[model samples]
Target chain A: MTKQNTKKLSLAPIPYFWDRDYTHQFYQQVAQSPIDIVYLGEVVCSKRRALSLQDWMTIGHDLQAAGKQVVLSTLSLVEAASELSVMTKICQQGDFMVEANDMSAVQLRTKFESNAFIAGSSLNIYNQRSLDKLKSLGLSRWVLPHEHNQQALHAFDLGNVELELPAWGRLSLAYSARCFTARTHNRSKDQCGFVCDQYPDGLAMKTQEQKDFLVINGIQTQSGTIQNHLEAINDDAVDILRITPQQNNCFEVIALFDQVRKQQLSVTDGQKQLTECTVHPISNGYWHQKAGKDWVA
Target chain B: MELVCPAGNLPSLKVAVKAGADAVYMGLQNATNARHFAGLNFTEKQMTQGIEFAQSRGCKVFLAVNTYPYCHDLPTWQQAVDTAAELKVDALILADMGVMDYACEKHPDLNIHLSVQGSATSAAAVNFFAEQFNIKRAVIPRVLSIKQVAHLVNNSLVPIEVFGFGSLCVMVEGRCLLSSYATGLGPNNHGACSPAEFVEWKNTDSHLETRLNGILIDQVAKDESVGYPVICKGRYQVNDQIGYAIEEPTSLNTLSILAELKAIGVAAVKVEGRQRSPAYVRQVTEVMRAAIDDCLTRPDKYVVKDSWNQTLGDLSEGQQTTLGAYYRNWQ
Candidate 1:
């Protein structure tokens, strides 16, 4: 079922808050890479204040010039009036395509005559009926829910609705406006003091086994293990390979995915390189219907 | 304060009303509402009739159109609002903005209470919905601590409803996809958890076990209850030591904290089971109503006791009750 020629790999926007200089540097390098599309903007708790809209626009333009199509991303956890207002403004922007991570954005996406926004995985899109409905609402493409298998994916009834699968990146598990990281630090949301920016990928939570089980990025706690589909990327069913940007060595991760996309690296070789380079282990159970942290080879 | 009870069907609605529930919330028997179950909810024809039945007994019937509408299905959502407005229920519990906007613009007279599905936890979020959608009340998310709810109510303009009794989620409300992470159907989209059709109970060993969509979910022991396949409340191994990796099987019990809830100025205490039996509705309603009454009568001696901890025996997957976000360190 592996498609000989896969849809090109894309770099999803950073889901955390990094320093402005670091943010500029990440995209500056992304501008020179082989990634197809780059998502820009914060998708976690609203307290990540390092990047402004103008800063996001600048990076979007820079990534576009670097030959990558940049889509502005709305925050997954929009908790306040200001966040909602910000979401409305972000969806209305004409220059860049928008990724509606939250349902509020979906409501605003249909406000205009256009229905071409990217639906984020957080939208809980699972069934063909749901997919068909979203397609009718003008969804250009949908990020498949993490727990889907080939049976579920192929079973999507509508032929027109496009599917984008997460080939790389730690699963964006859950979003909350309440920052667990801030609470862990004994601080309120307003007084969080930009603490989450310290950990680029996310703050890893280990079991008593001291095994890295989960990672907390502000209010959004993701799996500690990244999801790798180097093997599945060969399958024709994959319309988009989303490589989420982690805090460290993400450029190398993107390059490894590029090698797999180009067929230069075998799945075994890719797994070897991935194991060598990635500090954290990789899991694809989400695609296999086992466990979010299970590796199914 | 009002005690909002769940009515999965006509019998349950009547049971809740008879058991002293101030209000009963229900939905049109479809995926249009959050609790879209097989034997649950009312038909549109029955919904109209049920609203009248609740009214006859000095009880209010609120319609829940709380599921998020996808891109193309905005009209159906609009029509849902149109239908609810036409039905003239006391209120329409809403989660999505377009539906809220439709209710605000078309059914201007409708009292719009934000559904917990909306997950408005912050004063700012509550105020935002109040300002933009003109929402009259907010059902706060199951993430805010009691102090947090107090802070939120103090800062916001709208009346706030808190979960005084019901399903205590390990993860924050309106956020976690662990259920979807396991099964595929979840609250944000289909408004279900570990959908029954996807669940399978098999015999892996001596006793029969439960699986959600073919994944080995729970192993039942002799004399132990075989609960529903809820991702957050199942046992799993993190590093070889098997335990409840996601959440334990206990439902939230705030019966002991009802006085604290009343002191916090919460507008209503909501129970969390619409797909439950009429007996379940009556039982929970009687307990919560007693707790609220004790809060009003005794005042000083109104400490809600923890006796009715009723093992709820795997209620998270079916109809559940949680004290969501009212207490600290519930996990």
Candidate 2:
């Protein structure tokens, strides 16, 4: 862990839905890529069907073989009976670290108590007390909520705490039991013919004014604006810079973050390259105390 | 068999009780409850008088102290709960777990109805409240289909109330922070979503552009109707096609399906607006009351009608209302 903190990037597993082969192919290349840390498992909807536990473990092994730290991530909203089993399986790990997306994950991590686990952005970790509580429960690192801009993150940042700083990604805003992407296709969550695989990026949502509001990934709904913060990486103690994978140019996005983190490139250049990866436009609102769509740059 | 109504003001409480509400729920003029606003909600004196009037009319008064208590603001919540008990209100509708814990511990005998803000969609979640805090009933989420309700009600021990009409949330209740992210005011903690403070309307050439928190939520053509600038009510684009990608500006008018919900063993039908006008309250309550009566009188020949609009007057227009997940899944 100490050796790899030197300007490396992690390719976050595709938070949206993807086919098994696409996921396999994605991780195969990621294992071979410059990404130092690779967080695997489904973080959005439980019913995405892109990867099961066996497939995830296989991919995790492949990534491990490629010389990367594999962290298994849990679902953002753990509601139904089937979801509980998935959450339990993710926490019942020995080798890989786990990211706690919901309170269920937090509870499991609390039982492990001293064993370090990653806290997710969705956990509503606002003040230092909550951060201290997570730390008391063995919270190792955290992916900042997309809405937490540099300012709020800095305010909420436990200055000397052990949690890792999630440097960037498309903010995972909300989650629901209803498969929104499936609902868009007039399909039920149970009977839907796995349509989320068709759009690897996400299904874009527009307002009545025809403006982009959000994107439906699977059970998860994310801000349409890619809440990236590679620009905020200026002479700080950011341990891990997490970037969620898109359909294309994930490797390039990771490379850009690495460059910015190392001070090898200007923040402007790092963010400019990020805009081309095809997730959505870049936003830094959570840092600005403004709307998630409102970017400072 | 109770009708839980919202009273955003003293007058609304009067209207609600006069219009046949078995229970009327109100919050303080602060964020202690989910309907926090500047001019809306009751003052302490207004609440006391409102409670007195409701009790006189065989109507119960439920005080809402539903917002999650911030770590430092527990005293404000504790005082709000204490005040509700001191007023000797019929019941207290609560959402926050800590507040429920406090209320149950302090005033064990005060009736506590779980607020919909808790988002108790499952029986287990409801049972968690019921068994833990002695919660008598729960106001359910608006997302459940009637069939789902039938199944849920058939299996549950606690009585459930469904939101039969009014504001519909695009996502699940009690969890959304989109409003606070967009505006400083959020429904979860702030009790107002797309708060009026962030709303701006402009007549732009051929459309009424309704903006909330500077986000262009809707741009209605001269002929179209524009509803509130809620995130879910906004129109959006998918695959280059744009319209109301989430929900239309239509109100949740499930009065047509009141009998269907009643058949599912729903103990109460909730009307969604407390912030609406007295006339609005009177009209909605009268129509809902009439609908329920109609359900009992002509069970087989009952027909849901659109005359509730006469009560709302011009508050609504050209809404294509689907049963919205209460029958089929939302399209």
Candidate 3:
């Protein structure tokens, strides 16, 4: 491993709707991990209220006490006025940084005079001018979209703000108003009994040939294979690496990334261990400018 | 409500204008627009003639420069904006904030509408675009119920336009990456979804298989009808079942809710295809124009005629239409 400094590990907000106690216990464990910053709040569906704003704040404070930065994330799809109100409330929460997943969240945070906020990947900041506009709107950092390649990132001299890449976990591919999980159970979105909670990682979907295809979370569709960038930490194009929380062995995955990022482990050995840490198949194709499901290595 | 129709070529623009469309929307041949097909959209000279022809018939022309511009391709999108302003279209429909900023600063007097690709489903999102870029109107995504649409109409500072008829996009526009996940190209960047160049169809004695970038999207019996391989609409296996796990192939037809949409103060209704033929433009424009006229003339007694439904159904994908997310039950 090449020695690279100023790289940070972040924990993306949980995309699933786990029960309250299980969520708390998961965060409690996260506090002990080597993650430098932890994103908190629900980003998939507004209906998943197992963890209310107050509950998230409590977790944020606890994590902050554990010497990790905490960021409150807003929903990706905003359809109802009620969802906007919740986003407004999140923006009003004092002192914690906010991640604007949608334009609605950006508007609310700007209205609340947020000084430094993160632009979530779903906001789709593609060019330098959009980044400049977002910077004028008080953006401190932004995540690279899933489809952008290394060549695209080199085009922008993002010197004023840091760049974060989604280094690990399944890529969130799409979002819809209809919940596929609810549809899978023959339930309407309005009458969904929170069945998404039953699948901690999301319901797996495969092609007719039994090849893994996608994961159907509540309103979000994610890649079936986990994206592992353990081999690309020395790329030096990004300042931060984000690891999305998974159902099993997430901390173990984080530890491997920590060791690799710190040059305590060889990239080849870390890549091999990462394959064993998660049950799902792993790919790093998006970083290599291929189909997102392709394992470039 | 204004009847905004689509026109992929100059002939289609003329057909739509003659069919009584209030306005027609088209794109350039490049990736500056969403319908960036190989043989679709207009050249600069064709667009000039199209604008003049539509305006002479008292129909407006809106230019769509709606696709997101990446770091290396910003010049092309900026150039498209300059061309739209030079061509004197009635409005510029844009989705990218970077492009919006350039248009707003370079051509402040030009009218701007938020494209559906902007994916601003709520008033907050619309207001952000309006407040930041001075957008005059917004086309909401096809992911909201009527009640939600009404709420947005009531709260938004700009006029709201909703999709009235055309193919359905199940996922929120601009946010979906299923195509890029499979083909490495999507509507946001490439301005094409499941781009045709990457699609392949294989025939067997008993079945037909559709693939995108070598990934199997769907395989069906030979006798069954086949549609374009949209990733969301393809059949897949989930656990113990094999079916359309995400969504079935369908189109959105909101003729039944024309009165309701007008009652809620929707300023315009948009048709969602630009790669269709001139015949399609003529038929759909005439029906929508007649329907809007009837609804405006007598909102209390306006009804969707059976013949109109029959025509639209025949033109729809898989010969079926749904209320989409407009009806609460569809959600």
- Write the residue-wise lDDT of candidate 1 on A89-190 in tens digits: 888888898898866687677777665889887765644445555676778878776766665676565466556778878888776535656655656556
Of candidates 3 and 1, the better by DockQ = 3
Q: What digit string (tens of lDDT, one per residue) describes model 3 on residues B63-114?
A: 9999999888899999999999998999999999999999999999999999
lDDT of 2 by residue, A228-288 (tens): 7675455255556677777666778777777666667777877777777654566766566
How well does candidate 1 score on lDDT at residue A274? Answer: 81
After superposing candidate 2 on the true structure, give the runs of residues whose Cα lies further than 4 Å from its correct spot: A1-13, A32-39, A43-47, A61-120, A123-166, A175-193, A206-213, A218-220, A231-241, A259-279, B68-79, B90-114, B124-137, B150-159, B256-267, B290-320
Number of backbone collisions per candidate? 14, 12, 0
Best by TM-score: 3
DockQ of each candidate relative to the true complex: 0.15, 0.25, 0.84
Candidate 3 backbone collisions, by pair: none
> What class would a CAPRI assessor give candidate 3's docking?
high
Q: Comparing 2 and 3 by lDDT, which wins?
A: 3
Ranking by DockQ: 3, 2, 1
* TM-score for all models, in order of appearance: 0.69, 0.81, 0.98
How would you encode candidate 2's per-residue C-alpha lDDT over B1-331 as one tens digit per residue? 6788889998999999999998898999888888877789988999899999999999999998887655566678889999999999988988776677778889999999988777665554566567667998988766666776776677566999888667666566766767766674577557888888899988988888888777787777878767777877676667666665555666676766777777778998888888888887887788888888888788787786656644443444234444556755552
